[model samples]
Target chain A: MSQEKSLLNKLVFSLQCLPGVGRKSAQRMAYHLLDKDREGALRLANDLKSAMDEIGNCERCRDYTEASLCEICRNEKRNEQTLCVVESPADVAAIESTGSYTGKYFVLMGNLSPLDGIGPDEIGLNQLKTLVEQTDCQEIIVATSATVEGEATAHFISTIVQGVKDKQVSVSRLAQGVPIGGELEYLDSSTLALSLANRQSI
Target chain B: MSQEKSLLNKLVFSLQCLPGVGRKSAQRMAYHLLDKDREGALRLANDLKSAMDEIGNCERCRDYTEASLCEICRNEKRNEQTLCVVESPADVAAIESTGSYTGKYFVLMGNLSPLDGIGPDEIGLNQLKTLVEQTDCQEIIVATSATVEGEATAHFISTIVQGVKDKQVSVSRLAQGVPIGGELEYLDSSTLALSLANRQSI
Candidate 1:
């Protein structure tokens, strides 16, 4: 509503760069920063800058880290031979929060999109190749999403790992089906089919 | 997963300060910033810092501004004598977007919440009273939200204005009823009652 090129406008516009934030939310955020939590806003700004300046792709797994290798990659306790490959660093965090997997991760940064011109080389797949070869990994868990692009990426990686002439490394994808506690009636046919095809014994 | 004091962790924690952002969303935002739109994230950080450093309460209306007086208050074309009293700067933005009112605004910054110890002084109600008296405003449109605290604040302001012995100032609240395109069945009973009570003939 304000036609002027004020700092408030700039703040609102900048806030909209966040994934889901729209104009109204951006305005609310701007007002919130000015009104109640200036200290928090300033901290967020400082943190953003610091993170931008310091955080970069981990040399081993492509996860965001200040150091050359991420903590996961550097930890001696983690099973280096069992790498869980994920589409993004957020996926790595998601998998970590489960507290189940003790293996390290390889973040692809994004799934392969052919139409979008993103291929193996574009998203550090060559680096991933070098990583697979250099390390004596026994298994590669494909934790990419269940979407078409995610499946394509997983399949491509699976083919590459299978073709490794010198060594054999088993590749597996995350289970696909209806979610836990989900009703069969509400689930789509594709999920139901996947669930049926990959049915487990009780 | 990387329990160290990493920049990604710092970024995620800082992002959680934004409204409606939880751990997952914060993580996602952190990853998004690092993965795709580093430039945009940096811009947002810069904007946040600059806006925080420059923008402060307007001298007249308590709305955010780079200058002493906000643009609306500074505009000679706007009717200063007709004031729109609202709960926050966001409310001011909402009203301004309507383009119906040519009046100035007085932002309360917050509604009166006696339970939380937010009183007249906390919301700058005394300042509002002084502004009303000094400006000799003909009308005050209480455009606060349709909530208990908003109504209480509106009522408090209405009483103060009516009791002013020096000059006659009219105080009015925004109409509460069904929205313009809302269906009758879906309308809340309180709103329906209000609409029926305030019904007018075409």
Candidate 2:
């Protein structure tokens, strides 16, 4: 009985490594894996191992890829001149799913957090700077996030782009305002103020 | 990009098999497996496969086991004369975790859901009957559930026990009332009424 309990506990503990999963959820997942969908769990495990082993940062954009370069970075049709810089691979996926962006991406993998010891080198800001300097991209889109750290990272990146000699590169950010289909009544005061301040001409 | 997207989609779809995990959660899980806890994911997969292959119904009880008999059934210290009947392996696990019951158990694996084509044979009621008749158990605790179906199954089992010629076996159920520390205001009318009707004398 104790041995089986230990086994269950171990499985539950392992499941807790996932984002947002608490003890209850983990236990439920463990029981489910043991009882019902063991095959699915096995497949997921195999995928995780293979993905971890094979997927590396793309040579150009630093996104996850099984090869030297990601499919997006290798594609000649995508606008290399218009690069969107994001905080992580998940962000890259988010943008791609929207189907609105046809340009390339540069994944920082993390944001700059001095307190957490995540600095320029740690987040691959140096690599981004080098890429900006070398590439023929005339525009750099700093789409990090909306938080203070995100704004700070964007400012740092813009400064880097401005310092590059000879080539003229324009840096921009994602607009902060009311989201599409967002109701005014439900919006926070700060966001409402920002939306009013940055009001667009219809 | 499409190929990579499909791979991610496959992983996401697989993750959706977990209870309470929707598309958004599945995607998040997939990314977490890829970006952070690949090793954990791999281990989970291995455990899933091994558990599926090895775990089976215990001969004495229908609860999940790696051997012919579950640990609880094999344990000589437990009360063999008292058998608790439950609807699922999870129910057995729940009772075991409580550390209160030291008796044997018979897991039905499911309740009698006639609409879903589940009947006596489907839930191994015949097997349960045989075990009850054959064993020297003085008491049979029907702890299936508190639902309508659960009550019906318990009634059916009681009828079967009455039909047995020799030794008299006592049938019992889990008490239904306002849970410990439950507020009267929060409890449903039916439960509150039940608690009142079945009140214990101080």
Candidate 3:
């Protein structure tokens, strides 16, 4: 009985490792799994173990994959000449869901945060530079987020890619302005200002 | 690559079986686990598997346990003459946290919801009746929730226990009124009325 209680407590404690899960939620989740969805909990355990053990970073784009190349990198019809750089594999998924960008991606895994000691080399920027120099890539789309660190990383990448001696690479960034469907009264001042400054003629 | 993606997808899908987790949260959990906390994730997997496989209901109380009897049931210090009947193990925990209940518990696992096909027998009321008849228990405390189903279950248990012949068992319920620290103005009409009707002398 003591061992069983300890195991239950351990399960609850370990469940808190997930992002956004707290002690209360973890206890609720543990009891829920034990009571209602034991099968799903077991399946989740197996999947978590296997995913953690097998999934590795993609050799080319540094995105998560089991193989040397991710599915997008291996696709033949994708525009290899254009590389859209983003902060993480989640960004890759977000862009893929849009179905608008047909180009390849470069996942940095994180942005440049020098205070936290995350620099160019830490985010695999060297691998990105090598990929750009070795391939026939023509355009680099800086698709990092609009946060301060994201902008800094994008600027750094643009400078490095444009510094390539033998090839000319055009660098651009995703547009920053008020989001579609955002009301003018509710939008933040900076976003509204950016939208006004870069207003389109449409 | 396909197999790995399927595994990752399975992880995300299985995570959604948790209460309050949706597709977006599941995706975030999966990515966060794979990226930041592989050790914690693996430990969680092991804990989840073992907890699911080994944990079973306590034979006496019908509460979750690994052995035939739970810790509370095995303890000799508790008041065997008083048994607290609750709807779930969570209720037991809540009451135990108060440190006021020293009696053994009878977990119904669920309430009597006849429309959902859950009757007295479904909630182990027969076991509770047997326990009362065969033991020297003098009091039965119904600690079910304050909801409609909880009240119905409590009433059903009280009626069934009162019908038991050759034994005198005093049945009681947890008080219903204004919660501790609750303001009268903010409380609902029914709660305020209950508090007024059950007013105690200071």
Using lDDT as the measure, the top candidate is 3
Cα RMSD of all models vs. native, in order, equals: 2.4, 1.9, 1.5
For candidate 3, write residues A58-162 as lDDT tens digits: 888988887888888888899999999999888988888888999999999999999999999999888888988999899999999999999999999998998
The segments of candidate 2 whose C-alpha lies over 4 angstroms from its true place after superposition are: A5-7
Ranking by TM-score: 3, 2, 1
* Tens digits of lDDT, candidate 2, A1-202: 3564445556677777778889888878877876678777777766656665676778877887777888898788998899999998889888988999999999988888999999998878788888888888899999999999999999999998888888899999998999899999999999999989998999
Give candidate 1 misplaced runs (Cα > 4 Å). A3-5, A175-179, A199-202
Over the full model, what C-alpha lDDT does candidate 1 score relative to the true structure?
Answer: 0.85
> What ranking emerges by lDDT with the best candidate at the front?
3, 1, 2
Q: Relative to the unseen true structure, what is the Cα RMSD of model 1?
A: 2.4
lDDT of 1 by residue, A106-146 (tens): 98878899888988987788887788898989999999988
- The total number of steric clashes, by the backbone 3 Å criterion, in model 3 comes to 0
Better of 2 and 3 by DockQ: 3
| Residue pairs with clashing backbones, model 1 | none
Q: How well is candidate 3 docked (DockQ)?
A: 0.65
Candidate number that wins on TM-score, 1 or 3: 3
Name the candidate, 1 or 3, with the larger DockQ value. 3
Tens digit of per-residue lDDT, candidate 2, span B71-127: 888889999899999988778878988999999999888888899998998888888
> In model 1 chain B, which range of ten residues has the least summed lDDT?
B1-10
Best by DockQ: 3
